[model samples]
Structure formats: C-alpha cells, structure tokens
Target chain A: MKRKVFVASSIAAALAGCAKITNGLNEWQPAQPILNSAETLNQAIIGTRGTARLYRPGDVTLDYPVNSLDTPHQPEYLSLIESDFTTYRLPVGGLVDHPQTFTLRQLRALATLDQITRHDCVEGWSVVGAWRGLSLGSFLKLVRPKPEARYVVFYSYDHDQSGQQFYGSLNMAQAVHPQTMLALDLNGKPIDAAHGAPVRLRVPTQLGYKSTKWIRNIALVSNFKDIFGGQGGYWEDAGYAWYAGI
Target chain B: MDATAGSSAPLPRARSSEAGVVVRRHSLVTRTTHWVVFIAMIVLTMSGLQIFNAAPYLDASDKSDPARRVLSLDGRTTPAGSVGVTTILGHELTTTHLLGYTDDGQGGETARGFPGWITFPGYQDLAGGRRWHFFFGWVLVLAGAVYLIWGIGRGELSLLILRPSDLPKLWPMQAYYLRLRKEPPDHGKYNPLQKAGYTLVLFVLTPFVIVTGLVLAPGFDAVAQPIVWLLGGRQFARTWHFVAMLAFIGFFFGHVFLVVATGFVNNMRSMILGTYRLGKHEGTGP
Candidate 1:
C-alpha cells in the first residue's frame, strides 16, 4: 500500500507532461497500457499533485453556488432525511481490515475541517458552498483498509435519473486524500436535504457527481468490474466517465 | 501581418506567379491558428452537445416559472407531419432525424440533436465528453489568444475592421454574390462581406463564448464572477455559450458555401498553400 502511494505520488509529479496521453482522445482505445498509465497518472496527479486526482481550484475565494438539484425530490430520501440526520449512521465497511460505523455525533467528534469550495456540475454549472466535516483520510486511517482494497466506493441513498441507486467511487489515493471529507455543514449550516443532508462527500477537486451525497456506506474493493453497470459509478454505468477529475 | 492581409492599399496587385497571383494573404500565424481553432471548434461543439444531452433542459429564466423549460433536442420532440416539424432551432436546413429526436428502442421516446455519430465518444458519456471539451476549450482559447496577439501586434486585426468606406463595397459584392454584377470589387485579399463576417466572429462572438465559458467554469470563478454576475448568472452564460455555438455553426456553413462558389481551389490554396491564383486570367474557375 505504501509503495502504491509512493509510485502514485511519483507519477503525479510528472503528470503535467502526460496530460494529453492519459485522458486525451486515445483513452477510447482500451488495449493501450500507456494510456492506462496516463489515466492512473492523471488521477495520481489530480488527486495527489498540489491537488492531485483533484482538478484545479479557484485561487481566490470559493464562495459560489452555481445551481441546485438536477433531479426532483424523492419520497424515499425525503423519509430517510426526515429525522434531521440526527439519527443518521454512516456505515464504513467492505474490503477493509477494520470495518466500522459512525453516527452523526460520532462523526462530528472526529477531526473536522472547514473549506469553502466550488461544485462543478457536468451539465456546465458551478456553485460554491462552505463545507465543514471530518476528514475522510482520518476516517480511513481508523478503518485500516486492507492491501487488497484498491477502490473506495461511496454509496448514496439518493436515486439517479434512471431510478437506480446513486453511487460513486474513488481510487484509493482519492479516497484517502487528506482534503476529502464527509461534509455535515453547508454555508455555515447543516447541509439540507436537497444538498445531500445527513452527510455528503465534499470532494473539492472532483466534479460534483463524484462527491456522493446522502452518504450511506463506503465499500473498499479491488475493482469495479462487476459492480452496477460494471463501469464504476452509477453515472459511469450510464455512460459517464468513471474518472471525471476534469 | 495586417500589412499582408489588412493592407489599406484598396487595390489588387497586377503581378502574378506561375502557381497563382500569390499576394501574401494570410500569415503563417494566421494559417496555423485558423487550422488549430477549426479542429478545436469541432471537438468543443461535439463534446458540448454531449454534455447538453445529459440534462437537456433550458429554464425559461422566470422566478415563478422555474419549471417552464424548452427541452434541448435530447429532451424535445417534433410534432409529426412535415410542415411544422419543430426543428432543432437552427438546424432546420439539416433534414436528418438524428438532429432532433431519438427512438430509445423502447416505447419511451426521447429528443436529441446532432446524433451520436458526430458527437465525441458517440455515446452518452458526459464525463469523457467534458474532459474532451475542457481540453479543447483550452486549445481554442490559446489559439484565439495567439491570433489576437499576433493580429494586434501586426495590425492585422484591422483586416476585419469595418469602416464607412467598406459599406458601399458591400452593395457591389452582394450584387456579385447574387450574380447581378459581373465584375468583382478590387477589395484586395478579402471582400467587404468576408471582412464583416470574419470581424464579427473573431472580434465579437468568439470572445463572448470564451469569456462566458470561463464564467461557467468553477475554477475561474474568483476572476470570472464579476462578468458572470453581470451577464445575469451561470445558467445565462451557458445559454449564451450555446447561442454563440449556434452562431459559429451558421458562420461555418455560409463560409464553406461561399468558398465553394468562389473558386474553391483558389480559396483553399490561399489558406493552405498561401497562393491564390488570379481569377479567369490564371485558368481558375469559380
């Protein structure tokens, strides 16, 4: 695991030189290991570089809300969030050495960070909200993920446009990034239902979609080959790009 | 240099070359930027359309009527029967069904424009499409910056600048384009209409799209927020970007048709090979 982390940081160190080769037009050709490295290196770079794996951020103040809710309210989610998320329990399990669970209060007790950042939607809009939450990296350290765990998959209670369960994933480096957080507050207040209340993954570097909202579980897995649509995330299954750091 | 393409001589040269009357039309910088920007335009447009396909709704921009939406071709549909088929706004000339609708192979119907064939990845992958869009969007911006800087430094930007004197020349060129006038104006490298078209696209619309695109980007917000807020909002910037894209498409078709009608070889050769043959005298046909 340490070696993987070291190789990732090393590759990301030179990612700017290989941006074209990794996510460039050639990514469509699945057989090219060079291209695969480009992607891995891209994630390493974006997620690990200054904000590697993470895309670029505004050098200035990050307080902006582009838009809200691409989908309408769901009754299931409505009922689930009705208790004000005070009863919310975030289950962290699957391929890990120490599986654990945390209630809302317990999560609040962990080390927290407040960041004002932008949320870029794939549909070409952006919003900035202040997020305060416990660091995902701190939680991962506690969970002690097994060496076999490569992908940290996030499952949400929210339903997608296709009526299927919404889920997103991060490669190990992304999941364990120090900045990644389980955001409980938005704009100085608890995140409301429409904004992925209870808890949402506030990934300052990734697109809004990859930051799974209404968090329920985090599953560590070796690969996503057989999961959902077998591409990675719910949107990934519906033909979206799995690695959408851009 | 503007001295080459934007020369204020207002007179066509009498000299000629064996290949053509090679009066340096476009500069090396011009040619390179043009070709690069054209490719970037294709990639940006295709990927943009793909991103649009994911959500495909346009809010009518009224607080009380937030739900009133004009569906994009991906969400829109044409009322059957030929006369009033609600075409994808500006794509009326293109009769392909792919431009406005899709049969999802199931009973449920969907609306889409430009078809998957012309889109990047040619499938429903907004994520991949976005990467391509952002990537090429940067290329387009860089090339545009190069063109602008080169044109400004060389005074070539004046080539596309319109003046009161250029207006009268338009009437004669329009007549010629309509075949009413037999003799073409001696407007040198570019005629009045060409100048106006190029001017509007290069100095006006392209910048509008670029600035608005920056407004839509989350990363550029600190610097772009003022402009974005002034332009109504992020959604409005996106709306204008879409409008600018349509304007480009319109410009492209008209530009291509004119190139084909006015000695395709001479026009293409001038752009690519930097040598345009003298009309009729050089054995070239329009």
Candidate 2:
C-alpha cells in the first residue's frame, strides 16, 4: 500500500512538472530551426529567385480537394456570399506609404496574370490548378510598402472551430514574387464559396495552407509577433513550420 | 566429429584456442555505423509512417484523385461497431483494431491511417512527425556517407558487395540453412546470402528510397523537375517510397532472424565487441 501510494505521488509530480511537455507530443519548440534552414537552402540551391515556376496550361488539373472549407463564423461567410462579395473591401495597410481598400471589381481591373501551377498540400497530396489574378507584386507596388515592412500578413474571413480567424504571412521576398497573386478566378470560373470566393492569395511556392482564402485584409508588418497566436500563421501556431518550402 | 568436420576443407580464418576459434569480425567503423543507422532508421520509419497517415493514399499522377488511389485506410460501419478498412489496389480488407481506426492512447478508438503505438509521439501530428523525420534523415545521410567513404577508402565494400565469384556459393549456403546439406560450406568472413542482402540494401534500396524521398519534397521537385519527371512525378515517388519502406522492414525481419538463428550470442558479440567465436554448437551445423 505504501509503495502504491509512492508510485502514484511520483506520477502526479512528474505530470505536474511536465505540464507543458505533456499537453501535446509534437508541440515542443525545436532546438534547431530545421524548417528555416531548409527554406534557405532550398532557395539557394534551386535558384528559383523566390519564384516557383508556373506549369503549362495543358497540365491544368480540374479535380481539387477543398479542405477546411467551413468557418466557425458562418454568419460572416453567409453575408459575404449573400452580397456576392460586392460590399467586401480588402483593406491593405500597415507599414505601407499608401494604404488602400480594394473591392472585387477594383482588384479585377488591375494588371492581370494567368498561370497554371501545382498546389502541394502539407497533407502529402497535390493538385495542379490554373489561377487568374493580378500579381501581388503589381499590387504591392501600388500600395508602396514601406522599407521597414518585412512580412505581409493576410487576414481572412474564415475561422477554425475555436473562432480564431484564418491568417497567414509571407516574407517580403515571397510577397513581391511575380508568381504570387491575389487570385480571383480558378479554371476560367469565378471563385466559389467552397474555394475561397472573391479573392485568395495564390502562393505556388509554399504549401497549400500558406495560400490563404477569403482574404479580408492585407497588412505589411515588420514582425508577426503581435498577431493572433504570434506564430506568423494560424497553422504555424498549431505546430506547422512558418517556412514550408518542403 | 564437429572438431574434425572442417579439417578436410579450408581452415576457418581465426586464432584457434582451447574452447573455440576467435575471429575479429567487425571494425569500429562498421559497428558504430550499424548502431547509428539502426536507431536513425527506427525514428525515420516511425515518423515517416506518421507522415504517411496524413494522406494515407498512394497515386502515380502529380494530381491526386480519389478514384486512382492505390492504397488507402478508411473506416467502415457495421452492426457490431465502427471498424477500420484498408484498401489496396481496389481490393478491400477489414483491418479493425490495427489501422484506419485504433486506440487513441486514452482507452478509446480514433480514426487514423496508422495506429498510435507504432507512430512517434503516439499521436497524429504531421508537423511533429516531419520535424523528427527531417532531423533523423540528416543523421542517417551523414552516417551513411561516413560508412560509404570509409568502406570505399579501406576496400571494405568488397566483403559486403557480391562479386561474380560469390554467385555460385549461394545455393550451397541456402542448402545449409534449409538443412538440405549435412555440412555448411567453406566461406570467408561473410556468406554469399549476407553479401547479396547487404549489397541490395546498401546500394539499391537505400539510394532508391533516398531519391524518392527527395522527389516528394516540393522544393526539391521544383528544382529537379526533369528528374522528377523521369521518376513519373511526386505521387509515383510516394508510392515507391512506401514500397521501399516495406522492403526495408522485410529485410529487417530477415536480418534479425538470421542473427538469432546463427548463434545469437556470437553474432551480437561480433557486432558489439568486434569479435566472433567459431566452434562446436555455434550455429546450425558443422
């Protein structure tokens, strides 16, 4: 009886001491920043110059899987869908010389680019998609981001079950890449609710989650430390690497 | 009889003593690399399986299609309860309590491609699995490189690599193992089967697995599109990666079996202490 009690006490003490460690198995911070190093090495060796090359038009794939389609805030999505996104205004501000609010029509009127590219998901699946939109580089040129801006934070209408808004960010180099765009169309069709209607960021270089959908705001910031969860992106906060080049 | 069994054949290469003949079997490099690889491979394989559970499907085309799934783990409902179903090449098999849905580590069943016990962290966390996989992946590569460099420089690979002369001795070794022959054949440090198995793993399977692994990385694929194309795309690479993992697992079972069967103490001593004893009651036969 005494030994059993001692074992129980030890177990309790160990659990108490390792509260953070025991909460989640894969939640601990890495000793070495492998993801960051991999991203740097990938960039250096590939010589992509921050650009993930486009695919040929013939390679455009129609079948695509929609993941994390529903949002916790259904009313917000319903209102956007009800108004056909006409009332939607994408506010681009923070560390920019000229902050601008762009409507769907206004975004469409900007210099357009169409490219087919592969979307590699972190879940080990992939799809080739043809996207049409204005290059984010062209839009960033208009916004005139301040030299202090180091990252571009994208806030979207969608939220997880916990009501946390879906958000992601990109380094300045990737933000201004020619291939990165605020995509409006997919496969010659207007973006649907199932696929982040109105506008979504298309970052072919990075994993799928980085290409955030239903974008509501774009903020240029020096750091994402003050953002929600303070991990650059919602998924990044949930243990995914911020730089998912692999 | 056992003492005089090999008198007519070639004498074993060892220093004979009263009890037995002791031979220096492994070098420090070989033993160190072997253990390092063993640990790294365990971590790599478990974490890799965890990563695979994220998608749990294999395909050949660049774009994934539900219909073209070559392998998948999913759930099924029956009157008894929910069960796991594993589908391979359009053939379905009920693999309940093993895959698709299994113990959630809290005395409950949860849906997952692979079970919790076999996976690292005992939970489904792709990011965590990825971190562990990549970390050990580098360790494995570095260790393999060291072994390769040392093996080549010291001409140690000749023992592991099967030469044209080793081919003819394979059947005899097989016969000895199967007890079709009364006596084991005269051999050098490694038998013919050992040379073949080691050669296949060290040269063919490991390199193929590594190449396919690189292809699965989008960043690498972006740079080496031509090479990826030759491999038939990332999805194809993923399929082959799983196949290679299965092959490695099979090889591991066979390796352990041989180690245990052919005088477990002596084999372990050779690997760990760099010495092996050859005498009566050592292995299957004289």
Candidate 3:
C-alpha cells in the first residue's frame, strides 16, 4: 500500500512537470515575428479546423480548372502565361562558383523523362497525373555545388499578398534522388498554363507542396536557419513541417 | 519421471510466497501474451504515423524557384522562341512558357478512376487505406486470440472482467482521481478504469474502425448499399467513422498517459519481461 502511494505521487509530479513544459513552449513568443501574429494564429487555426468540415466527409473536390485541346476556347479562360525564350530566365545565385542564367530552351536541351505519379494533399485528397521533365539530379551536377553547400533552396514566383515567395528545400540525399525531375510536360503533351509549365519540380515521395509549381530562382545555402520565417517554406514558416516526405 | 515431478512440486510450494510469485498471480503464458500486446501497440502507432503525416504542414512560399518547383503539370513557361538561354546563379535556371492554361469559370472534364500522375494515396483512397489497415488488423486479431485463450486458461480474465462490486466503486475512484486525493483503489490485477478501457478497445473501438473501414472499400459497390443501410446510410457511416476515429485518438492518448502515470519502469518491466514485482501491501489499499 505504501509503495502504491509513492508510485501515484511520483506520477502526479511527472504529469505536472510535463504540463508546465508544454504550456511554456506554447506561450513563448519570438522576438522577431516573421509570418502571422498571435492574433492571426486563431484565424489560421480556424482555417485549418475547416478541413474537418469537408462538404463530403471522405470525398474531396479538385477545384483546379482543367483544360484540353478539344475544348472550345473561352476568351476569359485564355492562358495567363506569357512565354518567349528571352523572357524566361532562371537566376542561380548564392554560394556558387559561377553565377549563370538558363532559359527554357537550355533546360529542354537536356535529357528528359515522362513519369506518371500521384499528388497526395495533407487535407486527404489525391490525384494522379503524368509529368515530363529533365532530371533534377542532372541540374545539380551541372551546378557543381561547393563543398560547404549543405542545402539547396528553390525560390518560386508565386506568392501571397505579403510578397513572400513560395519556397522549399532538399537535403543532399533527396536532392540527388534519381526520381526527382524538373518537369515541363503533363500527360502526353506539354503542360498547360493551369499546371506549372516551362519547368516545375516532381518529387514523388513527398506531398504536393514539396513539389513547387513556378520556378524563378535557385539558391545554395549552408543552413536553412537564416532564411525568412526560418522554417524553410512559406507555409512551413506559418506552421507546416519542413520534411513533408511520406 | 514421477519421482522428479513429485520432488519439484514440494520445492515450488515451499517457496510459493517468495521465489515463486507466479503461484498467486498470472501464469507464464498469460504474462507473455500481455507483453506481446503492449509491444504491438507501440510498433503500430510509430510506423502508422510515418506512413501518413497530418501534423506540421510546410510553408513553401519563402523557398527559391528551383526549391519551390518540386512538381508541376501546368505549362506556365514562355514559348521556346521568345526566351534566351541564361543561367541565373551559375547553377539555377528558369524557363517561362506560353502554353499555360487559365481556369475560366467552367469546370473541366471529371477524370474517372484514379489520376495517372500522382502516386501518393489520399485519406479518401479507400482501396489503399483498406489494404494496409486490413493487413495490420489480421496481425492484431491473431495476437488478441492468443491473449484471450491464455487469459482464460490462467484465470487472468477474472482480473480483467468487471464484477458487480465495481459499479459503486467507480464513482469514488472518479472523485479520488479528480480531486487528486489518493491512490484510487487496490486493484487485484486490472483496475476498474483499465478494465473499462480494454473492454471498449476490444469490443467497441476495434470493431467499429474495421467495419466502417470495410464499408468504405473501393470497387466493392455490390455490398455498399447493404453496408450503408446497416450503418444508417452512407452519411451516417462517414460521420460515425470520423467520430470513432476521434474517440480512438482520445483513448490512445489516455492509454499512454496511464502508462506514464502508473510507474513507467514497473509497467514497462511487467509488460516486457512478464515479471511484475508486486510491492508489499500492493493490493491492500482501498
């Protein structure tokens, strides 16, 4: 009986300690706020909670607009993408031996492959689509990264109202995975504007966001800690996990 | 053989209260089975979380274009003839496109079956989900069967199954727990709360998760109607599944809390080694 009392008291003390640690971590506010403040945290939390309020409990609606060559052209639905060999320039900088620029043509000149894969969303939706592009490994080889380089960060053109760019990072292992590709085509034909074209990324093992859509620049960094939001990606800085691998 | 057996009998009986603790408690087989169940639960939880992640959503906006361009099917680059070949930062390259399509007000053709491009299965992908869940379930059921049989043979079930005397004791236990007054009761083997938890998990939660999962199986539309009706139609089943999942999550966390609270070392040793060192006056308290 005395032993049981001791055990119970010890357990109570442990639980109290755990509760204090959790509460403190949650309440601690960083000196420099990057994304949403505590006030907006509630709103963001509400938006995420809305996921449970799905119209169809298990069903998901793919709201992205789809297009085909056979469909009649609607002027309003006309492509928003503007393309010219000269207009498309990829800026590669940060911790590199040579800072160079590559147009759409240069990227296409390399070997390419077409792959069919699924995009699994965290909200519990999945869709399969064919993607065609050059291997990301091939591009990484061309860069000939410095010995100090530890992470490769992708900067995108798409952004929220804050002018913050959509970004993602890859460790050396995943960056060099043979399956990772910089895709330019969908299905059997070229990618439509609705889909990321010119060049988008395809990382089969990760979620949809890990595969960034629009490509505008690339940066090699020693560490991800100094980056904006300090969490690696735009959404990650807000609250998302950096490693979204399945 | 008879002489050896006779000699060992007196030896065990002589030390029954000292060296042979199993004489007054669980048999070796029952203790082993209980430990197996404990280990299985831990493995299932860890590996299952790795398969489908829900926590810690990533923010992709701050990343560079190459890092951000992880995957895309839409053509957004400029036409080949318009842009020049230029490297941005020695290594990174960007290409614009002309073939990008805009999503006007009209929704496009609904693709049938699964899309051919993406490989990750979603939560709604009943086919894939069922495959993994059922495979794991068979293992769980087999383990549970062995446990049930051993428990019955060893009279371990008596400790687990609630008795009439447990009814009134629950209120006082609850009060004790809420007020943090004292150790609730001296449980012979399993406490009232432990019995209730194990019962619900075995007879209620597991069955619900499995049956509802089967009902949502893909390409099995033949039984869909009957199953739906049994669950009070599709909507009700879906709602039930969601609610049941929440309850299971709650139970899982509560189970962990109990393990942590009830002497982690002793609990772990009991479940792993099948040897529980009952303290002096262990079952004497109220």
Best by TM-score: 2
Error in Å for residue B118 of model 3 = 32
Ranking by DockQ: 2, 1, 3
Give residue B261's lDDT in candidate 3 (0 to 100): 78
Worst 10 residues of 3 chain A by lDDT: A46-55
Error at B189, model 3, angstroms: 4.5
Could you give candidate 3's per-residue lDDT for residues B165-276 as a string of tens digits? Answer: 7767667566665876565654545566667777778778878865654333221212244564577533344345545656777987997787787668676665554445
Q: Per-residue alpha-carbon lDDT of model 1 for B41-151, expressed as tens digits?
A: 988887787777765544433111123343344333347532212333333333334445642212222455444545664555666666677667767878989989987
**DockQ of the two-chain complex in candidate 1:** 0.09
Expressed as tens digits, the lDDT of each residue in B3-41 for candidate 2 is: 212213433455222227765566678889999999889
TM-scores of the models, in the order given? 0.60, 0.84, 0.42
lDDT of 3 by residue, A1-246 (tens): 999999987965564453344233223455124212322332222211101111221222233323211221223222324333246677777777876788877877874766665444533234456667887777877777787877778876566555566688876655676667788876655655556655667675554666776666888888889898887776567654455442
Best by lDDT: 2
Candidates ranked by lDDT: 2, 1, 3
TM-score of chain A of each: 0.73, 0.82, 0.66
Clashes of 3: 91
- List of clashing residue pairs for candidate 2: none
Which of the CAPRI classes, incorrect, acceptable, medium or high, describes model 1? Answer: incorrect
**Which regions of candidate 2 are displaced past 4 Å?**
A1-63, A69-77, B1-21, B181-187, B278-286
Pairing residues by index, what is the TM-score of model 1? 0.60
